[model samples]
Target: MAETGEGSRPGYSSAVELRGVGHGKREHAAASPPPPATDAAVLHSSVLDTIGEEITGDALPEGHVLTLEQIRERFGVSRTVARETMRILESMGLVRSRRRVGITVQPRASWNVYDPRVIWWRLSGPGRNAQLRSLTELRIAVEPLAAGAAARSASAAERERAVGIAATLRALGEAGDLDRFLEADIAFHTLLLQASGNEMFGALADVVAVVLQGRTQLGLMPHHPEPAALDLHEAVADAVAGGRPRDAETGMRELLAEVRHAMLPLWEPRTRKG
Candidate 1:
């Protein structure tokens, strides 16, 4: 789910050796037996995630190159651990490993942007505002249509389930229980999309889930959700349950409009920075 991109050019700086990695720790490993496979796996994940974060967060910009030896030395990991990390990264389009070039960060445009972990890294990085706006725009474009389709196509049990989840969402939101609210919120979105019987919309539930969770994780959402937003959710659910496609679409649109309003401040700085 991690991704990377960028290459060395006139304006680009190529980091030959990583800052906290690509260094030495020979004696320590020499003193102890190699770790178990499980420990090795843990080591691999730690190294992978650290490097992944750096790549996506731009700590290691595109065109930066690191060697297997550098990674092993820097992370105090084995050559196998280092190799496997880069291998996974390459698969994610974050980096490319070659015999002579070492591991080179790719361009941003080359990243696996659809991968949720990639989305998380971007959202967790300095470029989060742009990612948030892009994902929300996607949700706005898809969710309303999904809602309408759910109203028309969903089974009776599915429709009732939507209303139930919305009711649960209302209770959790009013109680200021953000954690439960987030799960219920994800459930509501996921169910509606799935019940729409559209495979494409269903697949995007992950995207919507990430956006909802990221909003809470970033402290962007309030301790208590807006009353009107909660009402709109209920309205959408009710419309779906009642089989009113137009009302379902309108209610969903209104709910996302509130989301857009809430995110206005976050997006404002991107405009100014541009």
Candidate 2:
């Protein structure tokens, strides 16, 4: 596991200091009501996100002990907030709390890697390259199969939507609209999985979205997506729309292979370092 960086607990500035007000004004403000109930939820989420990132980034390695008291003290949060954070993390398989032994950070193997939130945290951390590589491999394995299935079995409306998304992807990629391109790219891939009519494959939509966004965020995407890649995407959409299973599979495989090759240089060094 690679340590990304130090994780600091969230904090709030004193309202008086934040406002840079006179003593009388400070006293008045202090007498006012505190923030709304939603602020507490925000605080809980902030603590949960910070601790989750630390664990996934290896800042808090497996077997490290934690406790509600420790979380409350470190983050200046209430015991309720800390307990809720722990409960969320436990549900995500990032930690395990025992009555007497305290909370221990779980091994990475225990994590719900397929969870979109987990994938997002990993992508935002130092281990992003590894996560991207893993996702790419997963996409390579399943996407072509999904494309083939979609071509054979998808409803007409699904096929039409897939084609429309691919067209949008091509337009966005060509215009160097990275944000929209990534969005369209995710939509195209996710639609393929869902249109395949396989429940298991459909559930991977979030996984594909994370991978697509991660690559763009990490600056792994080219300034302009290669013409060949764009062409393959169009080909895949056409084939699926035309109910050509073989062509859909072949085109999707080629597109994925090209993406993998393009990303190899970015991922190889990280692999060696790990």
Candidate 3:
């Protein structure tokens, strides 16, 4: 989200305003109808991003109240923009509203943890290391199983696509093309999940994409992916293409184990001295 003007509400300085519980009310003429479509789209995206960051960052902790009036006044946005922002957050399981209780941030357990945006926000905040560990553990559990399923069920085209993307990922990684490597890596894993022929596994593509991108963006990835890691990815693709379920599963386990090992230091607790 682009950085923009400061909030209009007193004691709130963020581009998107978030008022505390005890802030006093200000009576003003109702906000003008929202701006043009392009401007409105920008407003919506900005507000949604800011509010989402707050919730996932725990700045607006669970049970914090976010009233419609507070949103409108603090952000200097029309009621429509404010309501739409709230709707987006609600759909993502971040906040909920009631007649008298207002809009309250929901607990983390209630969130749509698999949603890419939610994953990004969480990774951007204080919980990043923990989130990374959790996501990697999840990938370790599921991706190997998905690889085996893909070996049995994937169509010819799906297998071909997976192999092709894996090749591209290996090339990009070896060349130290971080951005393109991240893209191909996402495509490779996503294809594996979709080819598994299990709806639940297919739906996890976004979650995997988020983790891959998050690792690179946060500078956690090595300058070039390890050669063995690239080789394991190719092995997974070849195994799935050849309908070798056991080999596919084994290749994925080894790849994820390498990843987990690389990430372990980040996940360890740090000590401070006086």
How accurate locally, in lDDT, is each candidate?
0.76, 0.77, 0.76
Best-performing candidate as measured by lDDT: 2
Q: Estimate, for each residue in 1-274, the C-alpha lDDT of model 2 and write its tens digit.
A: 3343323322222222222111112223312323422234578777877888889886999999998899999999989889988998999899999998899999888999876567767776777788889989999999999999999998888788778877887888889998777756776887788789897887776677667755776678999988888899999999999999999999999999988987898777765233
The weakest ten consecutive residues by lDDT in model 1 span: 10-19
What's the distance in Å from true for residue 182, model 2? 2.4
* Model 2 lDDT on a 0 to 1 scale: 0.77
Alpha carbon deviation, residue 103, candidate 1 (Å): 1.1
- The top-ranked prediction according to TM-score is 2
As for TM-score, the candidate ahead, 1 or 3, is: 1
Worst 10 residues of 3 by lDDT: 15-24
Clashing pairs in 1: 4-94, 5-106, 5-107, 6-62, 6-106, 6-107, 22-70
Cα lDDT for residue 226, model 2?
A: 84
Task: Please give each candidate's TM-score.
Answer: 0.78, 0.80, 0.77
Model 1 lDDT per residue over 135-219, tens place: 9999999999999999999989878888888898899999998877876787788788877889888767767766876687667
